[model samples]
Target: MRIHLSSVFVDDQEKALRFYTDVLGFVKKNEVPIGEHRWLTVVSPEDPDGTELLLEPDVHPAVKPYTTALVEDGIPAAAFAVDDVHAEFERLRGHGVRFTQEPLEIGPITTAVLDDTCGNLIQIVHTA
Candidate 1:
C-alpha cells in the first residue's frame, strides 16, 4: 500500500541525473546499463531508503505528445513534498530553477510548479 518507485520520462538520462541530483539534491540510488539506455534511479536525500524516482527515457512515439499535452495544459507530472513550500521555492529559484507557478496557498496546502526540462512539469508542495 505504498509507492516503491516512480518515474519521470526524460529526453536524456544523463541530463536528468545531473538535474535530479546536482540541482534538485536527490541522491543516486541505482544505475545499471540496459542496452543503449540504463535503469537509473534517484532518491531524496532526506529519505534515502524511501521511494526511488526512475529516470526513464521517453523514446516511445506516444510519449512526446502525451507529455507535451500535459505541459501545455499546465499539469504536473510528479510532485515532491517539502517542509516549507516558500522556503523550498526560494532555494530552488536561487539555484536557477524556473518555476511556472510560484507558491500559492490553496486551502490547507501550498504548491509551486516547475519545468523538469525533460518534457514534464514537476510540483513541489507543502501543507499548512
Candidate 2:
C-alpha cells in the first residue's frame, strides 16, 4: 500500500493556505466547510493526483500541547521534498519565511526547517 493523505495542524487555515500556496507553491485541492472550520487540503503542483496534504485545525484539546512541545524542541511537524534545499531555502527566506534551521547537509540529504507561522515547523529536504 502507498500513502494517501498527511496533515499539519494549523492555527489559522486562511493564513496557512496563503503560505502553503502562494509561498510554498502548492495548489489548492479541496475545501469543504465543516461547522466552525473547513476541510482544507492542498496538493503539490508537480503531483496533482498524488498525496494530499490536509491543513488540519489545531482546535482539539490535545493538539496545542503536542504542537507546542514539538516546536519547543525544534522538531518538524512535516517534511516536503524539494529539488534543491538551498534554493528553496533562499526563495522562502526572500518571502520572509522564518527558518528555525538553515539548510544543513547530513550525509546524502540536506534539510532546512521553517516556521509555518500558523503554529508549526515544516521542513524542506533534498537528497543529493
Candidate 3:
C-alpha cells in the first residue's frame, strides 16, 4: 500500500487554502462538500498528483481543544520540505507570515517554525 492522503486540522478552510496555495505554494486538489463542512485538500507543487493534505476543519467539538493545544505548545501541524530553509523563511516572512522559531541548524537539517495565522504552526525544513 502507498500513502495517499493525510490531514492537518485548520480553524478556517478558506483562509487555510489561501495560505497553503498563495503563501506556501501548494495547489488545490479537491474540495467536496461533506455535511456542513467540505473535504478540502491540497497537493504539493512538486508532486501535484501525489499525496493529498486534507485541510480538515477543527470545528468538530472533539478536535478544537486538541488542535488548539498543539498550536499553543508550538508543535507544528505539518512540516514541508524546502529547497532552502533560509530563503523559504525569508520569502514567507516577506509575505507577513509570523514565525515562532527562527531557522536554526539541527544536526543534518535546518528548520524553522511559523504561524499559519489559521490556528497552526507549520514547519519548513531543509536537509544539508
> Which predicted model would earn the best TM-score?
2
User: Model 2, range 4-120, lDDT digits (tens) per residue?
Assistant: 999999999999999999999999999999999999999999999999999999999999999999999999999999999999999999999999999999999999999999999
Candidate 2 TM-score to native: 0.98
Task: Please give the CA lDDT of all the candidate structures.
Answer: 0.93, 0.97, 0.92
User: Which parts of model 3 are misplaced by more than 4 Å?
Assistant: none
lDDT of 3 by residue, 40-79 (tens): 9999989989999999988769887887889889899888
- Candidate 1: where are CA atoms >4 Å away? none
How many Å off is the CA of 24 in candidate 2?
0.5
Winner on lDDT between 2 and 3 is: 2
| Each candidate's clash count | 0, 0, 0
Q: Indicate which candidate wins on lDDT.
A: 2
TM-scores, all models, native as reference: 0.97, 0.98, 0.95
- Higher-ranked by lDDT: 1 or 2: 2
- Tell me model 1's lDDT, rounded to 2 decimals: 0.93
lDDT tens digits by residue: candidate 1, 29-62: 9999999999999999888999999999998899
Model 3: per-residue Cα lDDT at residue 127? 98
TM-score of candidate 1 relative to the true fold: 0.97
